[model samples]
Target: MGADREGGARHRPVRAVAYATCGVVLLAGCASMPDTGDLRDVESTPRQDTQVRVFAMPPREDAGPGEIVQGFLEALTSDDPNYDTARKYLSAEAARKWDPERSTTVLANGPGTAEDNQTGGREDSGNLTYTLVGSRVATVDAQQAYSPAEGPYSRKVHLSRDPKSRQWRIDALPAGVVMGKSDFQRNYMSVNKYYFASNSPAVATGQSATVADPVFVRKRVDPMTQMVRSLLDGPTNWLGPVVRSSFPTGSALQKGVSSLTPDDQNKLIVPLNDRASRAGSGKCAEMATQLLFTMQNLTPAVDSVELQGPSGKRLCELNDDQAVKRPEYLYFLDGKHQMVRIAGATSTSAVPVPGALGTGDRELRSVAVSRDEHTAAGVSIDGKSLYVTELASGASLGDPVVQSHGATTDDRLTTPSWDSHGDLWVADRDRANPRLLLLEQGAGRPVEVQTPELSGRMRIKDVRVAADGVRIALVVEKDHKQSLLVGRIERDEKAGEQPVVTVRGQRSTTPGWEEVTAMSWAGDSRLVVVGREQGGVLQMRYVQVDGSAPDGLAPAALPGVKTIAASEDDRVPLVAYSDDGIVRLPSGGQWQTVVKEGSAPVYPG
Candidate 1:
């Protein structure tokens, strides 16, 4: 053994018994055991109701190769800050070469060792090899980006016994760490890394719409510092092209400043390197805003963030209230099929808006209001036509801007969504020819948006454009199952040519759900989704655009949900159409009936 040599000798007598007892308790609590088959399959460990702190114990004297390997695997999942105890089972050289933070491989279950498959020389030769195997679930890379992974996983662990002490030690092993899905969830949490939308027109106006890039970081392992570093590192590869960081090129945290904590007043002071000092006051303020938003979910909630240059001079500061806008009214169809509005956070009663659509001139199916709240779009009850009109009183509903030729309502147009740029987007699911269309300012000729991956068996079921106008969330159907996908919105404009638009690099944001019934953008990069896992009941939860589960408890469950709505400003209550008709969930409150009959609840983009 490596560092365990001294400690192992001193505690061998006492810890040996304790380790056996702990092992028994852990095994008893396991949901299922690994079977002795060609592929040893172990179920994920059940999560405990209360937090359990597990400490790693140094290896006992003269441990066998199997014991050393098992102990090392167990230690990797412990609460050890630096995994010092895990290294104790490795050879000195192997321990020095290991880099646990390189990446994390999550498996459906804890890895199982196959002792029967052990190879290499006999015990006398002091050389042996064992295999650890499991089914891969996902991976968190060096940049903290999380991606779902599939297929079987197998790795070899080589061991050699010290000739003098005759103690088995790992001489070679895989880099990073591997653990069951439950353990991974216990150790890691998702954080949103804010970035400016590169293609948004708002950026040119100095407003710079923010887009969230979610990443996973260890929950108890200096997460504040980890999140800061991840933010400076830029967006994940999938979102890189559509977003830009406000921090100057090569900007980084001041060297040797590792841990970060908010002060008693909930202010976090960040010290940046020389590169950040080059930014002007305006850009520096944007950078501070990014930090304020990124750190908003930390425990106790950071109220403000202040950035300092290398020379310890203040660059800028931003408070939470100044960094984000307050949510507006909740919009939905009333019992009479007329559009109605209510205060998103407080109103209990709903009233029709001042417009032709609100006056019930034409029956509506679903609706979307522009970000400016100056205009509105509505789909026909038959899902065949889309109508646009102003929100002002006496404003007339114009002729259908777009229509679908589908034979039935189930195969026609979906609810419309307006982007920050005032553009409108929707999917026409006509069985003969399904297509996604976008309109300029909600009035121009529909542009057929290209979606190469959505052909063949897949078709768009619903559409929700993000506030940044650079991303779109879509519910896609294939073989009767619906999946939520987030795709980058790419626009190509050339002189004298029709501006081409495409939804590219689409990735599933609801990998765990077998069917996604409805979803809405709840924040810059978060969505409130109503879905169900295979053979599971329908449930509502918040998920990041990057396919990672966000921190905090999931919303209290509501049954029979048909559609859901959430505001970019999270302070707004969530509204949904369910068996009980229109229902709203206020902050820290249960679902309350808003009306006996209503459908297609929504918040302005």
Candidate 2:
């Protein structure tokens, strides 16, 4: 998948294009072709209903060409369902062909220069032009795909007169719709669709590792139903191989039931097609988990979920408390290099891991814990080899999961990161053969991860995978500068074949920093990076995964900070190795020394 690969968008017969007009010929050409995706045709009733409210759409039938454009521009911001009222400004024929579902160009302001909204056209025919100006902030496609599109924008609405009605309306325009940011914010909501981790074996243990695929949906328009549909549609291609859906391959909503609605008691009733009836009790419970976790953000929240078959026969039912919550297990390498964990957010004491590995003689340089915390993969102090040890018994599962290929002593293995599904991610920066590897939770052999975007000469300093399993954060050395980058993880799992993992879309998380020493995911969309400007002291700051600085003050500086770790839970505390030794930031508290000998600290991803 490319940069636009994971975007979820919707469009049937509609096409949209963001145009930069220059020559008149190119401007006309912009109206000729469809952009975004392939166009398909679908039919629906045309309504300018007053009862169904959405964006504001004021009357514009009596307005002039300029006034019509201005009126429509103002009406576009109203929360009138489906922009039906906005359609009233269009000629009936144009209204029939125009599809707001094609795309939406969100602007910083609803519409600009509408005051000077000029019109140009011939007097003999029904053709006319209206230019509505504004700054484009982002574009959200019909499939709910969003992308930043910062720049000035021009909506050149080509209007034509309906031969019978003789009223001007937007006829040949761009494929997608356009709206202001304020209106978009009020109407859309961010939601996470839950899916089981394909690499996890927890299903046998009563709960599977759940991954959340975040997306934005229309808030008031049966959001729960839309969320479920999107979940059933499956994760985006980048995440497809990493996640599994409980809903069967061919399963769908029952015919004529386009959405799930809550009963009087606020319990959601989801009617699935007959395919869902084939699922066993275990499968039904998994499906219920997916639904309940997905709809947890809705207003009042869903207390329970009841799956119904085609004829309304009960399939499975689960209460809110039954949903599987995201798991967390924190561990760190102490002064003695023993694998130990923090007891609680407020507790300073560390506990030894259950297995011999926790108390064994082998000194660990870095450690990564599986979601189930049953096993851990650690890089030995020399960084020559990686070892997998059992947490309960201290028995060596694999003496050398992988060994270094680089020439020098500094060519070492980076800290390991474990995905929720139990796969371990680590980079062997041996200059001779620097490689990224993924260790299957229970399997011995390691799978090499390839990212063509990474420079061949670059050395991997650290690797951190997000709990969601869809993203990874990397500390790398290139051209002698240590940089921080985040990438989307994609996998190709073929039947009876070993799965191949690839990281393609690598993005900088600290674009302006000259060097990055340590980094970890602080939340789903944020990261804590220890960075410094050229010749400057290292400062630990909370930066968005997108590379923007979080609002307010940066987290208290970590003077002499060497390695850092933060919990996946945003509200959880942070820990780091500073000059003062193993120091940790308690929840809303100042940094305190947790262990004098601690070095590498990490929480379950």
* Clash list (residue pairs), candidate 1: none
Compared with the true structure, all predictions reach lDDT values of 0.79, 0.66
- List residue ranges in candidate 1 displaced over 4 A: 1-55, 116-121, 203-205, 321-324, 344-348, 495-497, 550-557
Per TM-score, the best of the predicted structures is: 1
- Give the per-residue lDDT digits (tens) of candidate 1, residues 240-328: 88888889999999998977888988799999999988899989988987787677643334678899987789988887663334546
Worst 10 residues of 1 by lDDT: 1-10
Worst 10 residues of 2 by lDDT: 24-33
TM-score for candidate 1, please give it.
0.87
**lDDT, candidate 2, 1-605, per-residue tens:** 01111112110001111112222110010112111122211111123222233444345443445445545655554444477766777766777887877677777766553221243234235666555567777666555545556678875667666677666566666665666766566555455567877754563355666765556666555667887788777875545666789888888788888657667766888888888778999999999888876655433335678998977799999875532343355688877887888766667778878775587788878888776667877778887878877778647545687888666546878877887667788888877678898887735688999888987867788888877676788888888898888777777878887787888767676765789988887755567888887788778887655443433356776689988877655555788888888887865568988768677887765
Give candidate 1's error at residue 377 in angstroms.
0.4
Residue 541 CA error for candidate 1 (Å)?
A: 3.6
